[model samples]
Target chain A: MSKPVIAIDMGGTKIKIGIVQGNTVLSSDSIDADSGSGLRKRLPFIQKAVEDLLDREGISLAEITGLGMASPGIIDSIQKKILSIDKKFGDAPGIHLEEWCLQTFNLPFSIENDARSALWGEWKYGKAKNFDSAVIMTLGTGIGSAAIMDRQLLRGKHFTAGILGGHSVINYKGIHCNCGNKGCVETEASTWNLTSIARSDKNFAESPLAHAPAIDYELIFNLAQEGDAAALHIREQSVQVWSACAINLIHAYDPEILVLTGGIMASSSQIVPYIRKHIETHAWTPWGKISIEEGEFPDTAALLGIAHLVGN
Target chain B: MSKPVIAIDMGGTKIKIGIVQGNTVLSSDSIDADSGSGLRKRLPFIQKAVEDLLDREGISLAEITGLGMASPGIIDSIQKKILSIDKKFGDAPGIHLEEWCLQTFNLPFSIENDARSALWGEWKYGKAKNFDSAVIMTLGTGIGSAAIMDRQLLRGKHFTAGILGGHSVINYKGIHCNCGNKGCVETEASTWNLTSIARSDKNFAESPLAHAPAIDYELIFNLAQEGDAAALHIREQSVQVWSACAINLIHAYDPEILVLTGGIMASSSQIVPYIRKHIETHAWTPWGKISIEEGEFPDTAALLGIAHLVGN
Candidate 1:
């Protein structure tokens, strides 16, 4: 048996830490982050959270093999450093995370972008297992994506290759993205921009969707189910954008299977089939059809992936 | 000294064959291909052409290392066979190219998609020679692309990953592509579809562009320079489409340099600057800016690339 591993998923609003061995989580904890102050101010809090979890589990640092971190930004895995954070944790790139780990735990550490880590986790232990090539799209506040090709995670020259699938332009003349690109899939359909996209529709003021307490995919889906015309139109438009994104990813990565995850997949029953139909109709795959499926292990995927990274 | 290699670039309208020694072409020949008759019908003609070229160069079968072929469409390089041809040569994929080469000359052979082969040629001997990681976009009748990452050509699981950059959707609601995808950069901006795109412009009928004898980028560019309003609008739209394609490639491959080539680049003075400016503004390269430049050796890139492939 190998020593247990410590895994950290540093998300935008919350930090999830786990003490894991193989597929089992021995102890886990979560804490809300001060998103306004950024990661530098929250590092000590994260350290305390990890230490507390280890103590509660009756485990010591000596028994821990290493730590694995999954962060939401460009990560240089080889350097165990965050290369850049996209507006979320502004100060993260300035901190030497590897040095912090070395001085605190006296153990080796590995880190990867959260989405890529989730892909690794899924490929190693969940839905993507047994597949040599696959792509995963996490549909949430913004779309996040990662691709695995021929069993190798495609970290390009600048560590920006596979992680930017969400930024691919689906509508050249559409709105601008914070990432500097225009008409990105995220700008068209992601949760962060959903309200703007919905309100921009000419029928919003006259539709039932305007009266909803909060605008979200869940509400839109329910409204669409109830036969709200504007809701149906918005749902169809969002689905088309998502489907276009799926086909773009299919063309770009040439994956055998595409795994869809994240918050919006609460409507996967509808989104999955819709994307599958679009890919079937639009994508030019000569070998055979690419399989589209919902991802398993959404919350724990990055944790599991980090554990694998540290353990290996 | 290495033995000279026979390189063949099987293009849509013409076949270019060459006797190459390293970076230098000792002798070369060209013949118009009967594109209507298909590749299988022209195999004998191609073989005879190669034989005649070798004879003219006073080279025997034993003196030549091997034959390297650069063909359009999906190619199984390991098998040395064309996997699928889009429309140019319908019967190409059915022929056993390697077996034919072996039977004819008893020599080892290698083949690659023309775009990929051209990329290899550029990386090995042309404008992209200095860059370890780069992408090449050949913009002509249609857009074609290939990428090299971390010094290795990116041939994905299905052999379609990096080569489908042109087919990426730029306008989801735009026109349909023959490849089944809608709003592809190729469909929106390529020469094969340019006339249709121009014809669809709202002001095309009112502008001088409608009276032009032929509809092509060259004519449109000349008209735009001469202050034709519709031509200028179309030119701007095409530039934006091409620029969007550039950003998409940069996001997909994460290369240090992007080489632009093909007949369309005859207007490199305008196209190059437009794409460069767009990438500089739109692409998110945290490490550094990606360099965009024109490709060298437009006509003989694949020949040199194939020579390098077979010689090695």
Candidate 2:
């Protein structure tokens, strides 16, 4: 039998680490991260967390084949390097991630962008096992996505192809995204930009949500369910944006199945069916129908995906 | 090459067939096509044209390893089948294209959608050869596009991926596309839809182009250069729509190069630079810049691309 593997999921607020023998998660640990401080500092903090887990579990470093890390940045997987860092992780690009792994555990390792890694996880052990071509979209602070085409991750020539699905324009004249493009689906709707769109509405001054210090999809869905007019309006609008984006994905990628996952999908009971219905009506697929499913593994998909990566 | 291949590009107006040895077109013939007559009638005409080319060039059918044909539709490349038909083709899905080719020539045959085949031609021989990842947008009667990712054609799971670039939503509330989607890039800016969009603008009533029998980008570009107010207004709008769509491709596919080729790109002096400027300013690629260029072979790209398929 092959040895177990370690998988790490690096996130903005929390870090999820786990051990997997095959498709099943053996044990896992979670910790709050000072991600705002930048990944350079977070690396040592993560090292301490991994070492503690290994010692507590009484597992030797040698028994662990290697580590699979899912991170938020443009990744040069072949070179095992991070290419760019967004605002969340300030100094990630310069971090010597591979060297750090080699020095710490003396093992080979692989890393991929978080969404792409999550796709790997889902394809390997979760919802998409039987599929070869699939598009995975994570509707969170910003929309994140990755595509698997013909059994391979479509990194493109610039390592950006499958990773930039969120930046697709759903409305050409709607709003300008931080990515500098106009009317991106993420700009129109995402947990990060949801409040701004709500404030722009004419009814915001008298709305109940105006009283909240910060806004997110959770509060929006909750308030909408409670029959708040402004919240309901925003919720419907958000759903349209996501639905339109999903339709675009269906047309652009031509996948047999589309996987929807993310923190925003916590209210998926309201989101998934709505998106599925919209794509059914709006998408122009002539051959057959495409199945849209709520992602089964939330945080654990990439973690399991990493374990599979290490095995390979 | 292992063996010379026969490549055919079938369009609504003309069919071009030739013997292609590597990137060069050896013996070629262009025949007018009466697409209104339907596929059953068009096939014999095309077959005679191919036969004439073979006889005139003194190329033996036995020496041809395979045949490749490019048409406008959703295609199953693996099965060498055409899966759908647009209005111009009358009805094509019922035809057994591969079977006919195999029986007629006693050789294996392959077929693909025209836009994708054009992209393959460009990647194999034209301007896109320098870049492994690229997007080719053909703005003719309607907009068509093909994407090459990591040096391979991205057929997606359902043969829909790159072929749907024209249907990208540029303006959410702009116009209704024939495909059931609203405000698609093609509906707003392609040659087929440009006349309607221009007619909707109030200024078009007074423009020189309004007097033309058939309005197209060629007439609009000409009138815009001569300082017609309505033509200039529509020209600017078309440029913006194309630019927005280009930026969308830059974000969605993250290709290193975007090759613009089509009947409309005859005015590429205006279109290519405008798209390049917009993408350079609007896209959020920190890796570097995306290069936009007019394709070296506009109409013949698909024909040459068919040769690449046969060679493969």
After superposing candidate 2 on the true structure, give the runs of residues whose Cα lies further than 4 Å from its correct spot. Answer: A55-62, A104-107, B1-6, B18-21, B26-33, B51-67, B102-109
Best by DockQ: 1
lDDT of 1 by residue, B102-130 (tens): 99878889998788888988999888987
DockQ of each: 0.81, 0.66
* lDDT (10s digit) by residue, model 1, range A48-150: 9999998899999999999999988789998778898777888888888888899988978899988898888889888999998999888887788899998
| Model 1 stretches with alpha carbons more than 4 Å out | A103-107, A208-213, B103-107, B207-213
Kindly provide the TM-score of model 2 when superposed on the true structure, using C-alpha atoms: 0.92
Error of 1 at B256 (Å): 0.9
Report the number of the highest-lDDT candidate.
1
In terms of lDDT, the poorest run of 10 residues in model 2 chain A is: A84-93
Deviation of model 1 at B139, angstroms? 0.4
Q: Residue B267 error for model 1, in Å?
A: 1.2
Task: Pull out the clashing pairs in model 1.
Answer: none
What's model 1's TM-score?
Answer: 0.95
